[model samples]
Target: MDFRFGDEDETFRAQARAWLADRLADDPAPDPRAWERALGRAGWIGLGWPGTDGRGYGNRCATLAQQVVWAEEYARCAAPARLGHIGENLLAPTLIAYGTEEQRRRFLPPVARGEELWCQGYSEPDAGSDLAGVRTAAVADGTGGYAVTGQKIWTSLARDADWCFVLARTEPGSTRHRGLSFLLVAMDQPGRIEVRPIRQMTGTSEFNEVFLDGARAAEVVGGEGNGWAVAMGLLALERGVSTLAQQIGFAAELEKVVSAAVASGAVGDPVVRAGLVRQWAELTTMRRHALRTLGATGDPGAPSVAKLLWGGWHRRLGELAVQVAGAAGAVGPGPWSPERPYELDEAQRLFLFSRADTIYGGSDEIQRNIIAERVLGLPREPG
Candidate 1:
């Protein structure tokens, strides 16, 4: 596959780079939620929309690759990756494809412009990987919308989100994965939603446990009983393309750490140098696989490989970064120390956090099961 960007592509990249540099200087970087909206207003929120009516960004393979490049460049520039869940990846695409005209007009612009921040309400406390088991009920209110009641766990940025794409059971007697519906709910409503922070050991509350009590929602996506399909579509977006972008960007960060380690003379030993070199090679291979899978097809099952590979390599990279950082990495600021300059202590935090990489987005074991059953043509295990 020809990965080289053409002259026009190169020109677009140059323009994007310059535009980002200028806008970033004046923009105040906030938490992930606020940064997304700021990006929306600055015309950087939706890199794939390809029309004047909130779709003019050319949503194609080339556009996807360009997005990868932009993601890498953003990380390289140390910019907080803006364009959070709803606007860029999950909801936007789903809405574009399945939403009605009213739904499209209502959601697309805000999402594209980053005026609205969003989160996913899929996994309940009991329904983690088995998303089809969503117990959140959405009974019709007779006046068009539905009243939702349920709890969702592991909601990323739920506390700060203005909107949420929720999966709820609309028909009580229907089997799991059937009779469910996709609804877009406003989080600002009273008595409908509550967000309890699940603080990580890193002392950051990036994910939250969201409780939905009689939350009012509109059927914003695929028709009733088609929620499972819509959810699957959303999962594909999350796992395949978005995961690759995230992993590639992360690899870039790891490279920066490696560079710092080598420059600081921390890799004087042959073993350490060899380990670093091996990791670099592994990262290179990982990037290739990630990009390929991202561009191959929008298949939800394919992302498990990228997620597993990324989780493994990221954990290793984090471990190596902390190992090379040594005492400097473990400790807080000392005047002008290496750790102090770039907040190297964050490396330790990242190392600790990376431990959960395999657990999130679908565990390594789950990914392996998919590979064996789907890719390897293996027999299913006895239930």
Candidate 2:
């Protein structure tokens, strides 16, 4: 497949770059929410949604190449991380695909305008990679709605999310993958939902443990008892053009590792130098593979392959970072006051955070199983 961007795509890329530059020119340090709103106002948020919905920026009209160009440009500009990424990238696409007209009208606008944020509630304490093993219960109320009651762990951005799209077993005796429903639950409701932040080794709370105690969800996407399919579809969307953008970020991190090695005299070590060279080559090859697979249909093994590639690559890069830093990486930032304990420098933070790259989202073992069973026609693993 040709990877060249056509004239129109190039023009769109120029326009996107200029807009981002102008938006960031003055503040140099604008608030993330404000930047997101600017993107929303500039009609850059819902690139793949339909224009008639008034939420999309006519991005659906653009070719896949244009989308890739925009994503690469966004990462290249070093803009603020998007606060609405979950809504725009994962939930919105899922809704557009399986949601009813009412559901679309209700949820897509706030997301398109960057006024709302969403978190996923698919993983449980026992159900990380085995998503079909979700046991969060969502029983039907006497009314048309359902009352959700369960706990979800490793929920990213739960503390800041305005809503959560949850996968819960809706039927009483439901087994794995059956009788499940995707329910949209509001996070701001009083007394029903609770979010406890999970402080990572990096000393940040991006992930959380969320508890739902009779929380209400009147909006169920893709009908009841069909959440497994909808959830799988959303997982597939997770490996879109965003992966290319992520590779750009990986390139930046790799550069930092190289720079640290050079500054700390680690580059003079032949083994360290060889490892850095190998990392650079692998990153380049990963980017090429991503570009090659950009517009392919949803192959069952594709997302798993992409996840396995980047997860392991990033974890290794983190290790290389510490090796480059040598003894300095062993120390914490400053003397570690009581008020600010566990503070870490850039290399330290990368080393700690990237350790989870292979575990979160999906594990390496799970990805291998997906490739074997789905792509290679191997027998399913005995449960």
Off by over 4 Å in 1: 26-38, 50-62, 239-248, 263-266, 298-301, 327-344
Candidate 1: residue 97 lDDT (0-100): 69
Q: Rate the local accuracy (lDDT) of all candidates.
A: 0.74, 0.87
For model 1, the run of ten residues with the poorest summed lDDT: 52-61
lDDT of 2 by residue, 84-170 (tens): 889989999899889987788888877877788999999999999888889899988988899999999999888878999999999
After the best TM-score superposition of candidate 1, give how far the Cα of residue 94 lies from its true spot, in angstroms.
Answer: 1.5
What are the runs in model 2 whose C-alpha is more than 4 Å off?
51-61
- What is the lDDT, from 0 to 100, of the residue 337 in candidate 2? 71
Compared with the true structure, the alpha-carbon lDDT of candidate 1 equals: 0.74
RMSD of each: 4.3, 1.8
lDDT of 1 by residue, 1-383 (tens): 44656677677678767866876788646566567655666666667654536545423323766776666566656677553655568888787667776777777677776677788888888888767778999999987899999999999878768889999999988768789899989999877788999967675778899888888896648887788888877766775455545655676667777787788788886766887888778778877776666656645456777777788888887788887887777775545655335233667877888888878777788788877887788998665
Q: Give the Å shift of residue 125 in candidate 1.
A: 1.6
Best by lDDT: 2
How accurate locally is residue 6 in candidate 1, as Cα lDDT from 0 to 100? 66
